[model samples]
Target chain A: MQNEKMMLEIQQKVELIERAAQAGTGIVEIGSFVHPKAVPQMADTDEVARRIKRYPGVEYRVLVVNKKGLERAGAAGIMKAKLTVSASNSHSLSNLKRTPEEVIKGFGECADYAVAHGIELSGAISTAFGCPFEGMVPLEQVMKVVSCFREMGVKELSLSDTTGMANPRQVYDYCLGVREQFPDVTWNLHFHNTRGMGLANVLAGMMAGIKRYDASFAGLGGCPYAPGATGNIATEDLVHMCHEMGIETGCDLDQSIAIGRDVQKLIGDDRGSFILKAGKCSDVVCS
Target chain B: MQNEKMMLEIQQKVELIERAAQAGTGIVEIGSFVHPKAVPQMADTDEVARRIKRYPGVEYRVLVVNKKGLERAGAAGIMKAKLTVSASNSHSLSNLKRTPEEVIKGFGECADYAVAHGIELSGAISTAFGCPFEGMVPLEQVMKVVSCFREMGVKELSLSDTTGMANPRQVYDYCLGVREQFPDVTWNLHFHNTRGMGLANVLAGMMAGIKRYDASFAGLGGCPYAPGATGNIATEDLVHMCHEMGIETGCDLDQSIAIGRDVQKLIGDDRGSFILKAGKCSDVVCS
Candidate 1:
């Protein structure tokens, strides 16, 4: 799908992207409010968010770091925003430069701002299950943050393993704990394959009745602070699993690979995914 | 704990290994049936199976390629033996010179041999979720294989998405389908992270009620045919997840890492985990 001559390729890409967005998979995260200096590729997230047109069935979301990030995201036409607040204050200071309480306060600010402007907010707690800096994140601490967000009127939640440090057993118990305490919040999983347990954690979370997992294209772009991991679970990989098991993700692996391949071409060797190295699981050979 | 001589200090390692194995939440995969020429690392499996004294409760299993492999394995002195039959003929032919049917026939032979010898057999349908070359394996085909194995009087079953090509949905539905069709067979999971969805697939599978899983230390051994994916989920990473969620794995992370690190020193950098690069998630500095 690459055009070397650049002859109206922008229009073609736009069309391809339009179709992808319209395919309707519930929620598709496009970008996050990451520091440009830390991740230059993601620095274009604002522009990427702006260029993406919303279709009827798809919910476009972006990750925001702070109140200012929320403002920038809103201006970029982001209808749904997910904010990060780490349970491990150590991880929070390293990643977000704020303590968990300060992050909770920031979420309160974002909720007030979003309500005033008619924007929807979903609170994403990074390292909810475990922290890279903190060996084991106690269930009580995770409960503290979830309760704070619930009190702040942020009803939607996204629990993240941020570092891919969670296992299936922990995922089940952790998610069950959260779901029992905050029965109304809709939460998804945010896992990285840092330690190669991303999908296993997803299974653990799902067993606890949590649906909607987050992944990146070709397993690209994990947190800068969480060094050594490659990416979130690849988008095509997730879709392939769902399709095989009869879950309704509403995504096409071929189409998603096409999307990821395009981005990979742009990123060059910085992105890592074995599927791209080999091709899709459903790929065929012909003479 | 290495000494001045730079070899694995055995006594310390044994104590650590024993403590970790005693934890009970971990599974040790003891063998692989790939031809010795192809996967030489697996050649020492018998020695590995014999040298390691098993604790009272933890499960110890060895891998078998075919009936011939089972015979060699039988002399190795293991309580349990695992078997594999690839779903794709091309891969089977290339890797073992046998079609899926022939491999299953081998499984039947091995089953009889195991029964006669009073050895427990755990059947692993390798490349079960999808094949590296063939692509898009039919569920009916997988079901047929399962039924065949069941009829052959196999006791336990392991469904391997060896290529890391499986998704949560596929894992969930596939496990559900197997559970419904063969409620008596207790199933385990063997996932690769070629596409970064190994752990996610585990999550989906767990939701479907399968608990036991198989993984290597530090994500060892990538399938040469699956294009981009590597081998099983890392044992240390998997243990980290389990311990984090308060799920009891009979292994410890520090101990597992020591093993992974030791193996890495032996292999000297080709296959290992990135978490080893960035260090542990708990390495964070709290404010």
Candidate 2:
């Protein structure tokens, strides 16, 4: 019964993804190839990847943690895969069952698999801003992970605030530091709104010249370790803010908001998207 | 029964203000002197001002809308008062029952009363960002209000986001404009967390060199006109963010969070103050 319910939920998610793609979402992370027993929600990753309607020029990406995940992605025929390693050793050990050094060492086989399978691979450094077990992450340690990914021939990288412990000043300074040290890498930011600074961090990243960010519809994705925390900055909220500031995001704000509202209904939650409740600032009809 | 309960709440709020002053808060707006029927939450404003314990060197400010409120504040023995007028004519009429032009025209008597009584006065431009009845406010209109305040001999000024509709880019640009145009004015910011952009706007204001901000304990206040809106940024959240950024706010974060927790218990809600729920980031101890 539980498996059937999970499969139904997955189907609903894929539908939401297709709608999001039609509404100008260029890239979507369909699911993660973790052990089904460990992350039950992602148990049907292969089915999701296979069934999700891929739009023209849109990338359907899956998260891969090890060689097994990479093989699963190949089986699922996923063209793009994100290989993520936690920056903190304690987090890496607890989350991935390996230390950071061990994860880096083990990435060789997975990188080779992606190269051979014609999969476009991108790297992510989780807990780059902070860790639940480690209060503040050192810049040198974060840079070390970046160097390891660069050594693996990855050009696009993401810095993940797994704990939502990032403040605007830290984000601005760190983004500048990373850009200065790794000028050739395309850097993306992933922030959680656990401490309610997600959008502020986005502003800081924009000030530091970062253009790419990771957001969830209705802010659905959150850190499993951070209890009572909210999810990533809502996609509609981010797009709405950018558009209100006269920054062109190339995404239809109203369409994204409608999809966010629809996703909220499918998930039975609207805790993440403020626009869902408050409407747009511009909606306050001008006389 | 309702009036008695409101009086009790007012007593509790006065105690909170006293505690806040002891915790290094140099200024506190104890209550607003709007019409009792219009804003029943502040019906006992004169009583609150008369009863709230005042700390030396700490300004116990009351918000006054016109000559009648100014007289009531005087009778309450308030030494410092904030005379606020809305930037949007619609908001001014809706909130103060007078047009913006009428409010300005009426300020002359209030200004004279303050000067005669030796009351240190400040002017606030409410709805300076966006209006519920009027979408985006023009910078020229905001500047015109600032000029009118300056003409009335007020040096301290507050730019308020009456509906919590201000964005970061608008804040930064407006702060710079205010600083350049009114170099001698002691500029203060008043923001609401309605769309979760309050702290982000505070960051932008700080980047543009604003030193003082208005925050509500436990985020206790919101515009009655802005439906589905949250309160001002929580004092604890703002102070915690500042401390985390290495900025000295001269306020105690733990004490403020404790007060916020207490306020939540009193109000039977915890919708504001992430720190009240998530605790401090430094609470995570590294092994």
Which candidate leads the pack in lDDT? 2
Q: Which residue ranges in model 2 land beyond 4 Å of their true spot?
A: A1-8, A226-229, B1-7
lDDT of 1 by residue, B1-287 (tens): 11112333334334434544754434455555446666665656666556676877666666776677777776776667777767666667766778888878767777788889887887778777777677756677788778778888875888887666677777777899989999999898888766656666666676699988877665676666545556577777666655655667666677677777766665556453655554555654232
Q: Can you write out model 1's per-residue Cα lDDT over A33-150, one digit (the tens) per residue?
A: 7676654545666766667676887887777777777887888888788877888888888876789998788677788888887778888888887776776688899889989988
Q: What lDDT does candidate 1 reach at residue A221?
A: 56
Q: For every candidate, how close is chain A to the native chain A in TM-score? A: 0.86, 0.94
**For model 2, how does the per-residue alpha-carbon lDDT over A128-155 read when each residue is reduced to its tens digit?**
9888787788888999999999999888
Q: Which stretches of candidate 1 lie over 4 Å from their true place?
A: A1-84, A90-98, A103-116, A133-153, A173-184, A207-211, A224-230, A270-274, A284-287, B1-123, B132-157, B169-188, B203-212, B222-229, B272-287
Worst 10 residues of 1 chain A by lDDT: A1-10
TM per prediction: 0.73, 0.95
DockQ of 1: 0.37
